[model samples]
Target: MQIENMVAIVTGAASGLGEATARALAARGAKVAVLDFNEAGARIVASEIGGIAIKCDVASAEGAESAVATVSGELGAARILINCAGVAPARKMLGKQGVMPLDEFRRAIEINLVGTFNLLRLFADAASKLEPLETGERGVVVNTASVAGYEGQIGQTAYGASKAGVIGLTLPAARELAPLGIRVCTIAPGIFETPMLKGLPEAAQKSLGEMVPFPARLGRATEYASLALHIIANEMLNGETIRLDGAIRMAPK
Candidate 1:
C-alpha cells in the first residue's frame, strides 16, 4: 500500500490529529480532501496542501454521502478513510444538577460512534466499486478512539460509551470487509495536546503528561499521523485497536 497518489479523505481535518494526518498524507503524495465543520480552516489546510476542502457534519448520513461522492469525483475513488471527527465532554453520569440528560449522552454516541460508521460505510462502498490495487487491497479505514474507551474513568459516561462503541465495531467490521481487501483499524490515544484539552491548567496538563511512563510527555499530532502512515503501509494491521497512548491508564477523577 504505497501512499503515493492514493486518494484520502480525512474528517476533522481542520485541526489537531486530522490536520496532521492530512498534511502527512499529502506530503507522501496522496491526494487529500480535508473535511471539517470549520469550513474556513478546512479551506486553509486544503490550500496549504494543495488538497480539496469539504465542509461537512460527519454525523449526518446525507452529509457523509455528499462528501464521499465529492471526493470520489474530484480526487478519484478514495482508498483511504480516516475518521477523526469526535467530541469529548467530561460530565458525570450523575451531574451536579441531577442525572445527566439522556440526549446529552446520545449526542456523543451519534457524533463519534455513528459518525465513524457512517463515513466508513460510504468510503468502503466507493472503494469496493473500484478495481483493487496490485496488492489486491481495496482500501483502509482508520478510526480514532480514546483511551477512555478501554479505561473509562469518572465523568466520562457519554464520551467513554461513544469511544467504546468505536472499539467494539473494529473487529467485526474488519472481518466482514477483509474478503474485499479493506482493512479497518482503530487508534486509542492517551493524553494529547489538542484543543479538546483546553481549559486545563498548565500544571495539570504537565502532570497528565508525566503519567505516560515511557515517552513521558503529551503526544504530538505528528506522532499520531506517523503511526497512521504505518498502519496504511502494513497490510496485516487490520481489525486491531492500537493504543497511541504512551502507556498511560487514566485515573478516576
Candidate 2:
C-alpha cells in the first residue's frame, strides 16, 4: 500500500528498532504516531519526525486502547500498525539463583506476546471501518520477533518463549484479518545494535558480531526499517516471519 498520507502507529518508538521504523514511515510521507513508555524520548523522536508522541504501556489493554483512541482522534484511524513494543529479559529456567521466578517469565509473555496481540486487534478493528484503498487493503501489521525464538541460547528461556509466541501468531492472525483487508507478518531479527546490546562491553559486542555467518557485524536498525517499508508496500507478502539475520542460525550457549 502507498504510505503517503497514511496514518501509522509505531509502538516502542522511543529507541532501537521502533525509533528507526517511525523515522522510516515519516520519511515516506506517512503521518506517524510514536508510542512508548518513555515519554521524553518519545517526544524527542516524534518532534524530530513531525509525528505525535503518545506515552503508552502496550502490555496493558487499557493503555493500548487509550493510546489507539488518541491516535485516531489526533491523526486518523491508522492504516499501519507496527508492533515493536517488547521486553527481552534473559533468564534461565534453572540458574545459579535456582529456579527462575515465574513472574519474570510472565512479564516477558505479557509485554512481548500479549502486548503485540492487543495493538494488532485494536488497530485492525479501527482500520476495518475505513473505506478500503484501491488495493482493497484497510491496513497492515508488522510484528517483531527474534532469532532467539527459533534457537534460544542458555538463559533465554523467557525471551525465546515470548518471541516464539509472536511467530506462532502470524499466520492465524493474517488469515483471520484477511476478510477485513488487514494483513499480518512478522520479523524475527538476529542480534542487532540496539540499546540493549550497546550496553555490553565493546569486546563483548565485537564477539557477538563475529558470530554472524556473514558480514561479521551486528544488524543495523535501518536495515530492519527497510524491510518493514517493503512489507508495507508489497501486498503479496503476508503471514510469514522473515528472518533478517545474516544467514545465521544461532548456536545454543
| C-alpha positional error of residue 212 in candidate 2 after TM-score superposition, expressed in Å | 0.7
- The lDDT for every candidate, in the order shown, is 0.93, 0.95
Local accuracy of candidate 2 as per-residue lDDT tens digits, 1-253:
9999999999999999999999999999999999999999999999999999999998899999999999999998899999898898987899889999999999999999999999998998899999999999999999999999899889999999999999999999999999999989999999999998999999999999999989899999988899999999999999999999999998788
Best by TM-score: 2
- State residue 66's C-alpha deviation in candidate 2, in Å: 0.4
For model 1, residues 7-47, the per-residue Cα lDDT tens digits are 99999999999999999999999999999989999999999
Q: List ranges where model 2 is wrong by over 4 Å.
A: none
* C-alpha lDDT (0 to 100) for residue 50 of candidate 2: 98
TM-score of 1: 0.97
Model 1, global lDDT: 0.93
lDDT of 1 at 173: 97
